[model samples]
Target: MAIWNSRFKKSFDKSALKFSSSIDIDGKLFNEDIDGSKAHVKMLMKQKIVSTSDGNSILKALEEIRNEISNGKLKFDWQKEDIHSLIEERLVEKIGERGKRLHTARSRNDQIALDERLYLRNEIKNLLKLISDFQKVLQKCLDALPEQWNMCVKLKYLTEKSGEEICQELNIAPTNYWQIVHRAKLQLRNCVENNWFKN
Candidate 1:
């Protein structure tokens, strides 16, 4: 099964059309990727897997690489297997044996999973903030009208529509759509009832 899955793994066959070769698609995550490296380094230090000096050196090298990549001084090779391998290779070149120790006990699977979880956690927080801002906008729209003119039913309809729009925009799965909408509706209700627009 693993072999079959690997067979179907995605490939990047085309060169990045960005300014620099290294400024490719993966370059967009340079910050997050560096942050992940920092976290991994801290974990390695805590586990005593690598000495403090080595860890610090690895971090410094990563920062320099990040700056180089950011400034377009670095160029990515299309033939390289993947980003992690490419990074490991660069580290080895920069810091010798100590750089080689960075990947000890770490699997590509776990590394990719950690990076994805970190990204999704951040995305979810941003989405929640967007939802809150949307609710605030709706509350303001409600406040501009008199209390008697404040149509709960109209507001409810708009809220439902907004939820539907969000589900559609996010491509939310049918199974999860209702739950997400329910939560959004509850948030809208709270915003409306609390007179959140008073401020």
Candidate 2:
């Protein structure tokens, strides 16, 4: 607040301050925010915008802040602006002058944007893993089917082929293709339900 007040004629209203605070909302983004800040520090050092020693100190203090937040030694105060300010404030407190350099080459909005992208990337990775696990379960069910049934399912669903193409590919008549597809459907459902749903 003191930093922000320097350019103002008078203090901002306290009620407006409470209304504008996003600390509680963005607190969950702490890990992403810390990660974004660390990356910023490294980039600044690489570009010579921030000295290596100063960046190192800021990084060290940020790591300490991360650990404290992780171990419940630090807590977010909703009265502050957001996680960016909170971390920056803590960093300045920890390493004094060096911590101020952490904000070089970035703004508060830039921090949240980077944090969100990193957070989304991590969540997307987790989603892909879950999809892979489900694919494994589905693969097991497909494997348990007869060879022709497996091929039928693969061509129709996995390969996104039409019934006519599938019949031509499998060298089966339309009636035979339908019969195999129906049986495959039943067997695959039973297999997945037995092996996947119960668990």
Candidate 3:
């Protein structure tokens, strides 16, 4: 296991000199990478490839490294080749001999591909939720305007414009527009509930 680890690390260090990482452009994969490592360690333990103690240690160390990177205590080392190498190097630094066991059965190729796919899957879910929320907010905004304002020629003109253009035309700051839109959505919900109960 140690020999395999040394060879892997050496290969990574050598490759680091040749390949520039996409992490600079797509660093959002950091969280997913960390999660993948956690799951991998669990699998390794289940297979008896690594001792439970070492597995737990690796998991804890990875979590600490993840938090450090996320909170800006650590910065990406672009010259370190890729995210997997960066993580492995950090683990070795943190856990000494035990860190060497973390990569027991995995190849860097599979590791990185898994991390990227998991990251993209999570990002898609988040984007879908955001779109749904935006639609709900838009519907609420439409329902909240007073009937006269809703039908007003000026309101129609503003609505037809892009949000940025509409905000600029109203002399409203972007933050103010967001706040108003959010509050209007909440009020619309309240109004609908009240009318439903009365009916």
Prediction 1 TM-score vs. true: 0.57
lDDT of each: 0.65, 0.86, 0.71
**Residue 194 local lDDT, model 1:** 61
lDDT of 1 at 127: 95
* Ranking of all predicted structures according to TM-score, beginning with the best and ending with the worst: 2, 3, 1
Tens digits of per-residue lDDT for model 3, 26-120: 46677878898889899999999999999999999999999988899878776655666677788999999899787778877777799879988
Tens-place lDDT per residue, model 1, 21-137, is 332455455566667877888889989988999999999999988887778786665444345656767787899989877667777677777767777889899999978987777
Clashes per candidate, residues 3 or more apart or on different chains: 0, 0, 0
Off by over 4 Å in 1: 1-27, 75-77, 145-199
Error of 1 at 47 (Å): 3.6
- Which segments of candidate 2 are over 4 A away from where they belong? 1-18, 138-199
- Better structure of 2 and 3 per lDDT: 2
TM-score for every candidate vs. truth?
0.57, 0.64, 0.60
Best by TM-score: 2
